[model samples]
Target: MSGDAVQIPDDRAFINFKNECNSEEGWNSNCNKSGITIWIQILRRGESIA
Candidate 1:
């Protein structure tokens, strides 16, 4: 499949999804950490900081 066809959603969608995730109990301590870590890795990669 083409990369465009598998593009990530916009920022608003990512925010909405993160908020929905935060509403779940225990999600903040576990899944959220992993999510933030992954996001940080992505940002670092984009910035060539990794």
Candidate 2:
């Protein structure tokens, strides 16, 4: 898996990881006190992988 992160305006940030099939699985951190939220995206059978 490969991962990257970026920060945007308004105290927002995003982090992501790409798997072998280009499916993304990662998290989002909005600079909040609570914490971050994680996510996963499974690629479809015919989806393009790049």
Candidate 3:
């Protein structure tokens, strides 16, 4: 997501609803594969979102 802001999506379902899409390339577990969930944070100038 190389833009002003990228939607990290509510889940992997939105970006990949394709039934035949692969696991890493797509959400093959119906968004149920739990792990380290990384999220995007939006910050203004001089803001810390880490």
Candidate 4:
């Protein structure tokens, strides 16, 4: 599988998608581990992401 590289957000954030994860999944698995249901764009750094 291949396509245009996902541009690092304007903040020069680091993006990681192991086994191909969407933003929602990435956020749930990393940032917001609570049961709350909300959506937000999170720009993570290399050290911030798992």
Candidate 5:
């Protein structure tokens, strides 16, 4: 799974993940509280791994 976040919608958006968190809760509080929206994407192969 991969994830992305946009702190701001305009050209001046901030995306420094390291600065936000080392934990999920920390990131949520830091980014979500500040009006950032988080996006997640899951990548998988059509064939099973054998």
Candidate 6:
């Protein structure tokens, strides 16, 4: 799996993730608190790897 960090503008932000899935499933999560936000992504493939 691969990910990146981005800057949000105007006290709010919209983010999108695009990728290809090959015999694997992807997961994502986001958190927001106290004017701070974090995003995460995880990819799993069979018991092998991302």
**Alpha-carbon TM-score of each model against the true structure:** 0.33, 0.23, 0.20, 0.17, 0.22, 0.29
TM-score result, candidate 3? 0.20
Q: Which stretches of candidate 2 lie over 4 Å from their true place?
A: 1-34
Q: Could you tell me the TM-score of candidate 2? A: 0.23
The C-alpha RMSD in Å for every predicted model, in order, reads 11.8, 13.3, 13.5, 12.3, 15.0, 13.0
Candidate 6's C-alpha runs over 4 A off are: 1-29, 46-50
Worst 10 residues of 6 by lDDT: 14-23
lDDT of each: 0.52, 0.44, 0.47, 0.50, 0.44, 0.47
TM-score, model 4 to reference? 0.17
lDDT of 2 at 47: 77
> Taking the tens digit of each residue's C-alpha lDDT, what string does model 2 give over 1-50?
55776656342222233232244333333344457644444557997635
What range of 10 consecutive residues in model 5 has the weakest lDDT sum?
A: 22-31
Q: Tens digit of lDDT per residue, candidate 6, span 1-50?
A: 55887655542332213224321245443777898856456545656444
Look at candidate 5 and tell me the lDDT of residue 28: 29
Point out the worst 10-residue segment of candidate 1 by lDDT. Answer: 37-46
Give the RMSD in angstroms, all C-alphas superposed, for model 4: 12.3
Model 3 has how many clashing residue pairs?
A: 0
User: Candidate 4, 19: how far from true, in Å?
Assistant: 30
List the candidate numbers ranked by lDDT, top first. Answer: 1, 4, 6, 3, 2, 5
lDDT of 6 at 25: 44
Report the error of model 5 at residue 8, Å.
29
Residue pairs whose backbone atoms clash in candidate 5: none
Misplaced by over 4 Å in model 4 are: 12-50
Better of 2 and 4 by lDDT: 4
**Candidates 2 and 6 compared by TM-score, better number:** 6
Candidate number achieving the greatest TM-score relative to the actual structure: 1
